[model samples]
Target: MSVSSHLLFFFSSLGAFNGLLLALFLLLKKDKQYTDNWLAILLILLSVRIGKSVAFYFTPTLDKSILQLGLTACLLIGPCILAYVAQSTLNNLTMKRLTITLSCFTIATVITGILFPYQDYLALWQYWIYRGSSYLWLISLVVASVMYARKNTYKLALSKQLLTQQPVVVLAGSWLIWTAYFTASYTSYIMGALSFSLVLYLTLLLALKSKWQEKASTTQSKYQNNKLSTEQTTRFSNLLNNLIETEQVYLDPQLTLPRLAKRMSATHTQLSQLLNDHYQMNFKQFINTQRITKAKESLKTYPEMPVEEVAERCGFSASSTFYSTFKQQTGMTPNQYRTTEI
Candidate 1:
């Protein structure tokens, strides 16, 4: 009932609402689904956790139910982070067993929390132990994501564009900010305010950026507007298409926009505009399309070639990515598609 308590609740509610909207965007937005569904799940979990904090502070009776619900959501954070980062880096293992195990653990945890009082096993020491482990696990995922980005530099499309570190850093920063509230009790409300502010700012910023970047990128180049006339643009497009389709530039498996632009004697932005305007896709999507097209041809032309080889020859860094891209593009796995073709 204190003024400070009410303020923290209000701000936390704001953060929660922002997070919910973002999760909805990920679920239903028209961006054509570049991000994995796991990211949306992660955001939902996070929104619940943030909202739970507000409930915890507002409820004078200190409801164990609200606290336990947040704990349950928190438990899955590590696994989801690992799964998302792994998939983002082109290491898209289904990890079904791991998911099942985590699910069971979450269920068991919820049951235990309900059966026992929060004061019993969920003491200060126990809470810190779990929180510490969760932080470590998250840090490990961030490090692993960065390491994979480095090691698989050639795996540009999936490895680099899968997940950016901005969200991860924001996640870590929010954790530390919220954690500081407990350590520095005198500044609890202040830290809570700061945490909620960061969440709202970053969440809205991301949504706006996502919604507007296509438009922004469209006008980003003067060359795209009028530097090249229609005929010139057509010629460049033809040349670029010929270069990739006939010369097989995509076979390198690391054919980024910059590399393609260099080969075409055009700037990166120009190439981006060319693809965006001509193909209605970003550079990565365009490249992946070419790869998938090549994969389809290979499947029928060289029926004896292993699917793995076909994946590599088609410029996919991993067979998993190949199958996923192929399935996503054609609605069938490579083997299934091959069967239908032959």
Candidate 2:
């Protein structure tokens, strides 16, 4: 390759390499949430797919199996991105539903690959599989966009807050841009990879910015070094318990730490210290625990009640959140749990 060609190769391939590294970091990170796992999977699949494209664009004679592998990764990217965004927004269908959908897609892809290997059916692979995968990816993006819009319709006015609060929107928009470039005949094949590289660096910058803000907030907060004494801890715990059990304050979907603290006649620092020190949970975690507990009881008692209604009654702002949280806590989706109870 010439000097310019070599530089292009390096630039195009850099993103895939960094993406794989980022995915590995996410996988190895401790105390990962479901959203983290989905994001990791999305990154890994995207890296594989992009890597395949860069290789094929440079070396058209790449092995057929390698081509097949890349296309399969491409096919999976649609579902992976959908799941990642959905999980991030807490607006996903049940995990079981997602699993079944993915399994069906995998089975179909495998069967087709076996029946007509890419080497034997190059045209078929080039046309049908390529188009199908691209369409699926577009469909996933459309669906995810609609879901996010519905979830954050009210927050759209505050662009800064939207970027910080829904980083997934920025990521999804980046993915959309890459997809458009990849599918457009006017754009060079390497342009897609370059777009991905740009987005990956943007993601890194956003992540670092968030971390810095968090560190700055902690440094500024008076409660950073605040701790409850044993007696104060006991007293605060009793107050929290009474607020939750007696008042059932967790039923309010709009509840916040400050609001709850005010209600409990305690300062935010005291309430935060109580939850963190005594329960080993943050404010949101503690509140979600109470809500999940209530959901479990409601699920068992009123098996006839719709799961959505149960979720609302138990204080979840969205049924998707309820489904994900209940499964996380109870090892079953609401419907699955209901079936077992029956």
lDDT of the candidates, in the order given: 0.66, 0.77
Q: What is candidate 1's local distance difference test score? A: 0.66
**TM-scores, all models, native as reference:** 0.60, 0.70
List candidate 2 stretches off by more than 4 Å. 88-93, 165-174, 180-183, 222-282, 285-304, 307-309, 312-342
Give the top-scoring candidate (lDDT).
2
Report the Cα lDDT for residue 187, model 2.
66
Total clashing pairs in model 2: 0
- Runs of candidate 1 with Cα error greater than 4 angstroms are 1-6, 30-36, 58-60, 94-98, 114-148, 151-193, 206-213, 217-342
Task: Summarize candidate 2's per-residue lDDT along 1-342 as a digit string, tens digits.
Answer: 999999989988998999999889989999876677877887888788889978988999899999998888888877877776666454234645776777798798889889999999989888988888888888887777786676555445646545654345445654654565566688677787777787888767877897796566556556455876888888878888888888787876656786677666667777888888789999988999999889888888998888877887787867778888899888999889888987
lDDT of 1 at 262: 60
Best candidate, TM-score-wise?
Answer: 2
Error of 1 at 309 (Å): 9.4
Give the per-residue lDDT digits (tens) of candidate 1, residues 46-107. 67766766666666466666666666666665656655554434322334555676678668
How far does residue 253 in candidate 2 sit from its true spot (Å)? 9.1
